[model samples]
Target: MENTHGYIPSALLAGGIAGTSVDVALFPLDTVKTRLQSAQGFWKAGGFHGIYSGLGSAALGSAPTAALFFLTYESVKHFAGSETHWSPVVHMCAASSGEVGACLIRVPVEVVKQRAQANRYMSSLQVLKNTVAAEGFSGLYRGYISTVIREIPFSFIQFPVWEYLKKTWSEYQKSEVEPWQSSVCGAIAGCTAAGITTPLDVAKTRIMLAEKDSLLSRGSIRYALTVVHKEKGVRGFFSGILPRMMWISIGGAIFLGVYDKVKKTVSKYYLKKHDHIT
Candidate 1:
């Protein structure tokens, strides 16, 4: 993490790579989770249970959304990265801020992707056209608020734990930690955060996947809870929890491993070039 520190552009590139790679690789899992969480469950969602459904939209949005997140996060962290006393707070704030930028791009893509996963639309183009025609441009951002709610805490929980763990590992190892170390830290944090946040995630997905003007379309946390509770009891809120946990846990490894690798490669090249210049 330190090697990757002090560089904003590097973070953008690494974040983009990490975000794109994980989302693309785990997209099938995401599709399955979304389908399972739908009010209709897996059977009612139609199709031949194609796991990779709607991957295009997800991958498209993932790059920029994730890039923006790291760009903002790294930029903020750079200012306070070295401040041990302020490390956790800095990581928390930076991660929270990062999600704001991420959500702008992510929410729309998620809207399209989730709908496609539900078999509401066959193509990304169709999802976009129909969404705009149905709810105008705003329709693309249908679950914007809920996404922030779900994502911000995820970043908050993940980054602090990641930062602390990285610091501890570096101290214990008496050397710069390797990418694999970062991957393990990231996996643990991702699993913990995703597990804790499943309820909010469930709500976010339900609201985003809801049809226009439908009862389920309400984006309020309260609405999501009511629907889940009234319909399937406590279990409804945890419907797709298993698939999601697996996706996130593994996705965390891929994301952090790639992010650290890319960060090292990029930063080393530039630093070496700068040394040659000097």
Candidate 2:
């Protein structure tokens, strides 16, 4: 097995590919999720095209966000690894760190995307211009805290489960060559995490797309929660859970499957180079 403690360009490359793949593939579902979670109902939010309103920006941002996240995640995990392997704590921390870094890019994309999903923007560029004009640069990061609250617990749960599944599969099969196994692991991990964090996600969407005078306007997390509950009852907390879960389950599988494939390819390329040297 290749040592997991070394700097590997392939890890960075694979992560970018994985991140972009999932985000793009899942962007439509993500739009649907954001729309359902919005204060505005679906018809007011427009039809099929509205669901993909900010895809241009989403596609543009996906690669870099994914790249940064994977690069940070892989590097941190490797550096934190012991002679043998990383402990569970190391995996969690690395995932969190990677996510935090990726969030820098993700938040802006989300702001634009969610606004579009809510029918708040005529176009992505208009979203940026208007946000800047009204709320300044900071407006683009409307749901920063809520996003972190949602994402951290998600990574904490998702990565550990994913890692455990990968290890189990490898140990039983005596090989790590199974990309489909990684996909299944990813799907399970993502579904569990997405379900748990649905409330936080709802709040984040509300905060980001809320109008100045609306009940869902930018406010405290508790206020947002109370507002959603008051309006939609307990079911409000899970408005977008359906599309979100589908997006996450399939997206996770695709993301991990691609990452594993690229990592394996990179490992083989280096191994071949080393053999030639010897």
Candidate 3:
């Protein structure tokens, strides 16, 4: 059996690499999604131009945020005996906890990233400086609550589905899943989650990209959603659904695939080294 101690380091490194890889690789898609969801409309929000505008902040934040999330998620699973039972509830809880922890870093990053993506700022640093100067330090965390609200539900759906799919495949095949299989499972789960939770995502994007001092910028999820509904109707809630689903689907595949591959490799190496010492 693998030692529990090995999981921590594996989770950290694998999560970091996976996060950075997916974010940097799919940043253009994410930028398009952000712009599509922007209140200013697509063309006004830079409309496919500067698709890589926020790549720096996304790259910088992805590693740490993903690392923190997986660290929390794996720790919770290990402690909760998820390896033995692998309950969906446990997966949901672990994913939720991971989202909560990850969002601390993620929200600030998203604020800069989405703003840059919308062409409001030329660079991550510029966005950061202007936001702080205008809205104070709290500006960096503009959509913290809304983001958590969006992410938790997304995790509630995605992680449980991913775990269940992997488990089912493993049972059917009578072997552990390949990283590519995990990627497929992750893509399915992410796409499903993205489609269902699009309204919440739009709400988060609206809150983050809202003008300073605007009602939307006040960060009330309900009010922001209400305003969106009032302005654009139900369709507004799904503004970026296509790009969102596409980005997340591809992103999930790369993210989870890389994570599984790196974590397994690192864990196996660590176990072998440990056995040698013994």
Query: Model 1: clashing residue pairs?
Result: none
Ranking by lDDT: 3, 1, 2
Cα RMSD, model 2: 2.3
lDDT: the better of candidates 1 and 2 = 1
Cα-lDDT of candidate 2:
0.81
Which is the winner by TM-score between candidate 2 and candidate 3?
3
Error of 1 at 97 (Å): 0.3
Q: Relative to the unseen true structure, what is the Cα RMSD of model 1?
A: 1.7
What's the TM-score of each model vs. the native? Answer: 0.95, 0.92, 0.97
Model 2: worst 10 consecutive residues (lDDT sum): 1-10
Clashes of each: 0, 0, 0
Model 1: residue 212 alpha-carbon error in angstroms? 1.1
- Reference-based lDDT, each prediction: 0.85, 0.81, 0.92
* Residues 1-278, model 1: lDDT tens digits: 46543367688789999999999999888887888888788877753476677888988888898889888888888876746787888989999999988899999999999888888438877888889998999999888998899998998898899878877999998987789999998888888888888889889888988878997676897888788899999988888888888899899888987888888888898888788888
Q: What is the lDDT of residue 4 in candidate 3?
A: 64
lDDT of 3 by residue, 1-278 (tens): 33465899999999999999999999988888888888889899898777789888999999999999999999998888776665788889999999999999999999999999998448999998899999999999998999999999999999999999998999999888999999999999999999999999999999999888898898898998898899899999898899899999999999999999999998988888898999
For model 2, residues 103-160, the per-residue Cα lDDT tens digits are: 9999998888778667744788888788889888988877787787778889999888
